[model samples]
Target chain A: MRKWILLLAVFLAACTTKPSFTSENVYVGTDGVSLAFTKNSPPAEVFENSIFPVGIEIWNKGAYNVEEGYALVNLDQDYMEPGEFTGSTSIFPSDASKLDFQLMGKSEISQQGDRDTIGLTVLTKPIDILSEKHTSTVSVMACYRYQTFASPNVCIDTDPFGIRENKKSCTVSDIPLTGGQGAPVAVTKVEVKMLPSKSQDKVVSQFRIYVKNMGNGQVVDASKVADACSSEGLTKSDINSVSVSAQLSNGIVLDCIPKREGNGGLEGYLRLKGEDYVLCNYEEGVPMELGTFKTTLNIALDYGYMHSISKDVTIRKSAVI
Target chain B: MEQKRVFLGVLVIVSLLIIGCSGSKGNQPTAVEFRTGSSGLDVTFPSGTPQQIFENDIDVRIPIQVENKGAFPQFDELSEFTGFLWVGGYDPNILQASFEQGDIRKQLDPEELEGRSSFNQQGGVVLESLILSVGDLPLGTAVYEPTLIFYLTYLYKSIASVPVCIDPEPRSINVKDKVCSLTDFRKIYSVAPQGGPVGITNVEEIITSNQIIFKFDLQNFGTGQVIARDLVSSNPNEGFDWRDLNRVQIEDVRLGDRSVDKCKPDLGEEVELFQGIGHFQCTLSVASIASAQAYTTPLTVTLTYGYAQSQFRNIKILEAIEI
Candidate 1:
């Protein structure tokens, strides 16, 4: 009897020791990113027929990694791309210019922060200005990918004798999983629960997923763009709009819809646990006589995001004329 | 010896005569210096002003004028003041002197003064007359020349302005010298930017016997978008039109201890500013036209408007200069 107990303990330890993957890198949205035109870089007072340098600065204020980050600037005809000027490069089509940069995430622990800058030289075109003054507007847009992470623990138990102290003492299995690969909406947590029914003697598994808005913009219903939450404003249609799903080890997939209140985007649809989450369940017809098994939970969330900034530019008649 | 004594006396007389002539020449009347007041106003009784009058005779009139010879320009509401003229010294039982028209309060008109007087184009002189009536004098009076004194009291004012540049992005450019003058850069002047759209650029004063007029330039210095208070909507879904959202209510316009009763603002109720920078020739009439010497009185202008200012300053936009 003692030998059997020893063997059981060893087996349980082996099954419950599931290997988990370390996620060192995550991509959230650019919400933590900031961009600006450095002071006096573009020459506050620019003269006509001469190339002036405009410097753009970028800072990453978030914890996630951002990739393929770039800024595009739109200006009026009063400015032109440098043709033969030094450090002259054009990244956009007519009426626009682009600047690329790389940055590291801001870390409170290591006290490490990421910031970078790019400079562009553009020719100033002469124009007739009455009252000796002229003003122009420049629009700037940044594009990049960001990510969010959520992780929740689930209890898995499968003991027919009703002799197991807890799921941790029972022989259990773990499967490594990763998602939010192709879409902007990503799921970070996948928790599972396996329990036995007293009367039917059947096994039921429940899955819970944690989701977040990892991008620089707010998450909203993919079907609604104009009505989505953004710097422009927020509406009731923006709440609990994320759709999540889970796939069990048996290949069965379950979906959890956010519980919402009223028709407004502000209340209802239970994603509000301080963290947005959804729950799904799967039940088997009969109890398993059994052995320790491995299971994988796959999650997916559907959402939409938006970001923007504006600057005023003043131009002077070039002294070159 | 008598001849010699007479000759000596004649010599002494000649020397005395010469000294007397020199003394008389030095004592002649020198020019009288008349210092102008800070309000740029000078009130004085012109020549032919009556010094005496026969008691109990109506239609006795006295003429007085106030000279606005200040360096600054005067407007109806800007530098306007009031004046009151009363005839004293004559016994009230024997004489009744007051504004001939029963309008003791003098509302000095700068425009009218400018048109009537040749003193200065910007500021001119305001003139008025006071009539006196007589009560029953001492029975069977043969001759009477009562010394009647004309006492004047008025409110006076002055105004000064300097240039200021409004810039949202200060670091992007050196705007200290970039803009010229605030008054010249913006074509229209408004006193109200977010609150009233009514900008009081300059102030003037005019004093009369019973009331004082404060003439000021109420302008729209900013974008003249004015919204009336009653027309304001509470719907969150509907966006606000900035031009229609600018309205300013005159909470209180006071001078010293008295409040102005008659102030004509173009909008009828609140001051409305629109069409870039609109302007109103506003007038404030106060009954505090008491008798006081040329002095400065506290004038308070309080306004309430849906004051909101949100504008992006392009460092490239140069300011305007009056020069």
Candidate 2:
């Protein structure tokens, strides 16, 4: 009896699938490159006329490598100065307090993301004669270009008049998705509809893809990311825009309409203000005899994300002064 | 020993008495199984609505209590909602309602609000605040009394499943022990009304050589009036008018899977209920190729109509400080 029990256990174990991490699974997470102030980077209190260090850590928690990224620190210039970290001799983020590049995202070999740090020594300028203490908010910005890859199963029904319901593998319905799909932006839902063709040939598939910025960052237009960090200042339109394009598994790209031109043909990308969706139609109506089938809808969202974190530092007057 | 035996006999008698008493009166008081009722919804304006309000009183609230008092319940999956309610009959400028023109058309219950039954005797009561502070009442020279009419409109369905005998040849005298006689079909079959305010009360059958004719009598068991589908205004701006009452739409009359297409209402498809009853007749064509064997099919009569009930209130807006 004991031997039979052992054999039964072995058979059950063999039937169960051993869980393993695939290359696709490594890229799935809700995190993106984030900026954090190290513990006491700007000490709780700093004496007047004394020099202190402000530090920021840039962590790439996403799967995609950031080709062009930068971290800019903002401070009240009246009460502080870069001191020796400025002028022609300055090496800190090229004297402008902007740290660029040198960060790699998550990979198959290293499941965890790579991280880098930046520290800058600065002087606290003298305060007014009467004020005993002064406090200022120190903020840092991390901006990077990222991409989201989503492959959700889609239903395609070619036959119109034929009753293919009982035998069909897939039904046309909205597919709701949760959790992030390998990037800062996530495809939340895909509404599937098999509409009758206008030419009276057969039924065509139309999908509405809804995307949201899951990461705590303001989305930017992919084409304008380089310009945003460059000499040209970032405009209002440059923010809250995501470039989106989608295709089917059969290599037939979907034609998404209601496009707003300009921005590297991200296929008339949607302007993201919290959440948005795009409508794509399979224009070449499938031949009537194909019946009902299931295929994957591959969607790619290419955009720039910018996140910010702020800290407080109290400036106390020196005893002798 | 004799006294102990007497005591045992008394105990047995007492046990028998208790069992007999409980068994005889156990089912006397139970929740009433309400199959027939006169009203689907018992609507009444509760207290707090002022019959007279001064011009200074900016807020005048009127509350209307809507109770599902019939056997047909309002379910989310079966029907979108019980019906819509609107209050009109007063000048919009003088007495302005807090609700918008679109907001006036309100659904009775979005979720499941069951009607009268043995399980839920009182049914579901939805308190709808009708006039939430009728404001901007002009200070007239004399006492101004405006009659405000509050109308409730909702689509309701009434179904009747009647067991009917299909006779291939009713004139065949040689047939012995026939399944059901054409003259005695009324006594053989019964009409079961499937719980709606409007129901089929009686049915009379007529047999011909090639057709079976059925005459049905439909009545409004509800206290409220039935309205024509076309007469009710769907436009939010138009609201409810007085001309939209007393007509019921004959949706379908079917026997098993096949629809009896020859069914016709006495007046028309949308016929007005005289007093509270209406008549509908349909001719079911019997195929000449049917077998001599007699079979029975449940003839179903479905009616879709808008039920409406109204309550009017006369209010006088007096001057803030009497002259």
RMSD of each: 40.6, 24.3
lDDT tens digits, residues A131-190, model 2? 899998788777788888776655665643444211233356788878777678988999
lDDT (Cα atoms) of all candidates against the true structure: 0.44, 0.67
Model 2 DockQ vs. reference: 0.00
lDDT of 2 at B241: 38
- Candidate 2 recovers a fraction of native contacts equal to 0.00
What is the per-residue lDDT of model 1 for residues B56-121, given as tens digits with 9 covering 90 to 100? 457777776665543323343444433334333322333455664664334455454332112443
Choose the strongest candidate by TM-score: 2
DockQ of 1: 0.00
Report i-RMS for every model.
Answer: 52.3, 30.5
Worst ten in a row by lDDT for model 1 chain A: A164-173
Clash pairs detected, candidate 2:
B38-B222, B38-B223, B60-B133
